[model samples]
Target: MVTTCDIIRMMNRISQYRQANRLLVIMPTWVGDAVMATPTLRALRNLYRTAHITALTRRSNRPLLDACPWIDDILSAWPPQIKIQRDGAQGGVFGVVRRLAAGQFDTAVLLPNGIRSALTTMLAGIPRRVGYDRNGRGFLLTDRLAPRRQLGAFVPVPTLDYYLAIVRYLGAEHIDRTMRLFTRPEDDQRAEDLLVDAGWSRQIPLVVINPGASFGDAKLWPIERFAAVSDRCVDELGAFVAIGGASKERPLLQKVIDRASRPIFDLPGHGVDMKVFKSVVRKASVVICNDTGARHMATALGTPAASVFGPTDPAWTETGVAVDRQVRVDVDCGPCQLRKCPLDHRCMTRINPQMVFDHVGELVGWNDELKHKGQDQDNSVARSVGYS
Candidate 1:
């Protein structure tokens, strides 16, 4: 096995000149940010057209990377949480760094704004290192771009746009904001089968509800609010609901499912791998989620999505690039981007459940009164035709 340090040296030699053909990308380890990095990956593909682009990311997020077409290779950084865990797991980072150095990448784009990502790319000795100038890692990066804007009072942008800025540093003239993931046709078939197995109607529009956000309390919408919106979808449109997330979020997912009066197919802890998960979202008519990884996944899969934002500004990766809309309450104190709320999480709590329900109704392509009237008209037509 090649050592990461040796790989770095080799990559540096190959990349000393402009090879453009062999480019390596370092992904943000966080699941949400990993998805946000998709636009950057797409921008690279757009610029190079024929370059082999490999992405270095955490092992747990391999499924998402595997399903993405923009990535040529999926390099795993085991214990993807290692950086966040460095205070507890310190001894093995050098070994991990060494393995990374062995890949012989020409150009390295670091998506995570942390010192660790830049240091790893530097340690790997990739010739060209690119990232934002933050976290005191400016010396490690060869290309540092200024952040587009500061966070505002209530305007939330998505994180994907921030990651795409690196592509500009690589000389990309046109940057597309649409995030993308690719799935095999068989994967879509499998998801359809799963839906049928769960007694869901494939013909009816599908809605995926993800009630968890991993960025702590910064981006979470109230669970009760999620349930309220879910119930309206079921009662009004008779649409099938698929609740998805990892095993860790099951408790919160269950709470939303329990509050919903309509029956929902709970896929929490359902071992649906990333490919299948992408397929699931692909078949969904719309996705309702917090500003979590799944929201980005839904956009990549081309599912119209409504993502709620709270503490984190959506400026880096704005929602609705491919989704229909991003629903955030106009709270005066929101976009604080804090892990924990200093003021009782009022930003998220004040959003009325009715507001979410109203948003859902809009996406389903009808207002509440319009839906009722349409149903009444359909009933009248059936009665006039003597079919009822």
Candidate 2:
């Protein structure tokens, strides 16, 4: 004696429950892009409080979300040959897909727009696949969103906003745009030990200088320019200088340290992990770096940064905070988004050491009282974003 309308209503409720229960998110490959997607992850967690959210990202970027409360689990998206083996099989592409299917994810949100990301979800038999309609993968998605276009071409939106749009399409509400990061007590202790070992005191103002950019030489500011700024920061601002970069970038960073008139704490060759790097940035008075992951990390840690922009547009990577400043020179053939520059690199050359120092002074108050203020102050963006 049940009515057809009642049956239909029951079916709809069941469908909604299924869609909200288990979600797999494909994360962006680059470190900076992955950091920018954090707010979207936070929004998804808030919207589906009961859901189990898994992030699929490169093995190298797994540490980026180490203590992020929004993420429930982590899965490596490394090519199957490189992934860890499980379930009595040599992990190849098909083997990985088989394991993914066993997870029974009801929905997938593709933060990476590549066709392979969509294909993985489809092959796993996920009931819902949502992503931007790029790389000719629209046919694979259940909810294909068109990219924002201008002048008949897709315009580059802020990476933070681009990821947020996907979650909004999935009915997530009350989005907060603040980026957040966390550090462990061990990381803080390590940072302190490194500073003391290098004959630096935690009581003095510290300025971290990052001279290497993973993108290419076009994005790098001149090493001598970095040395000049470091020397000035030491002399004028009474700041201790620390040179930071990945292990592969040790040579480049050493060149800057060698040129500096003052001694610099060499952080690159010391085998400092990401957590330690974040802790160091969190304690710094200011960070000056090329447009790279360190720049984004400093912004998320609520540390003032003077981020230099050359081959990339600042608008696309805006920190969305008042304390962060972008130093760039708008030269004619610039913001080309190229890994290598064919012409003279005027864009970076025009941005001198003085220009960067001025921006740092403006973003981070140079007064004695402000310079000595602890990072734990109430005005810190990290506190505002629910982290310390």
Candidate 3:
């Protein structure tokens, strides 16, 4: 039924859409999600070489994209109190829409599935709004994609691949799966200074441990177990142990520190920002952490990491990179994906320090030469073996 002329016209229109000059990409709110979106962002940049690519994300997540060459600008989507105005008057939501309209973006790709994200682009009158058809926002998107489903259920895809699907739908080519992160020179210098101040010599390998999880307490391994692992790393491998996490995690870090047999550096207690944190992780010989942002950061930086999993499914967060070593105990109830556990929390408690230490030692090539140094330390501090 289609004529040759009609087919040519359709092809021309598609070409025009692909040639859009100004593009806005809505990024996810979480730090790990933002990091995972980097590959999609890079693909978009490469696909539209001349387009001005701006990344819109939450204020807290802006730092994750620092030094990203693909992004021309990073816009904050949060701090609701901060208003954008038009015509010399405060615009509120309407004003925000007006300001976005003024930019005349040809296309907007929504990475987050929330209705608010779609509504913003739709209200802004972007000609080409692309996003998945979930959260009841399909009506607002000009290009709505239905997620792949199986057996009457939406299959859970890795977050990294899930994000990349958006750019792929937009005709992006040569999608790079390698996750990327960047840190400033000053951040690296600060990290070096911190290490020097901690009396950590360059000769000794550094093992960074994160004992907190923003997801929930259920995701956290026991503080005593973390302390035991730190003690073992210091004792057997002669590695300098450092504890790092969000500022809110200082109490947890202190618990680990108080129980540790030897002194450990507290990075969060020293007020290290995300930039400094990335620098620190990049420099570390190995990182051990819960199913949180720190693990993703370490993996992206090509640093070896032992990522502990409890209630969360490892497949959903898998880095798909060789550097990550995921650790989890087989429990009858878990991968429940619940923020809080209703039971005894055996999923985490059963995973002892020795199990973690063995995995970490394997990844970092543990030196038996230093085992003699640990022999004099108190063996009864905590049971270090026979964990199922």
* lDDT of the candidates, in the order given: 0.71, 0.81, 0.78
Q: Estimate each model's TM-score.
A: 0.80, 0.88, 0.87
Cα lDDT for residue 62, model 3? 79
Better of 2 and 3 by lDDT: 2
Q: Stretches of candidate 3 above 4 Å error?
A: 1-17, 79-99, 366-388
lDDT tens digits, residues 1-388, model 3? 9999999989865854567689989888777777788888889888889899888877767778888889899877542223555443423556556667887898998888888778877888898888899989999988888998899777878999998887777787678776778888899899989888888866677899998888888899988889998999899889999989877778888999999989899887787888888888877767999888887777666566787889998877665665577788999998788888899998888888888888888756522222334521111111121101
lDDT of 2 by residue, 1-388 (tens): 8999999988755644344688888888887888898889999898888899998887778878888899789887544454445553625556657767988998888998788788777988988888899999999998788998999877878999999988776676789877777777788899989987887775677899989898888999999999999999889877888989887888998899899999898875777878788888887878999999888888777777888899998778875676667889888887899998899899999999999999776554632245455435222434353232
| Ranking of all predicted structures according to TM-score, beginning with the best and ending with the worst | 2, 3, 1
lDDT of 1 by residue, 1-388 (tens): 8999999987765543344767878888778788777778888888877888888777778777765667688778643344444443423566656666677776787787788778767876787887888778999888777664556332334676667666765667767665567678788788889888887764576788988877786677878788877777888878888898877888988888888888878874566776787888876767888878887776666555677777866665664442345677767786777988888787788777776666666655532232345432121232232111
Report the error of model 1 at residue 342, Å: 3.1
Q: Report how far residue 180 has shifted in candidate 2, in Å.
A: 0.8
Candidate 2 has what TM-score?
0.88
Best by lDDT: 2
RMSD of 2: 4.3
Off by over 4 Å in 1: 1-17, 78-91, 148-158, 319-322, 366-388
Q: Between 1 and 3, whose TM-score is larger?
A: 3
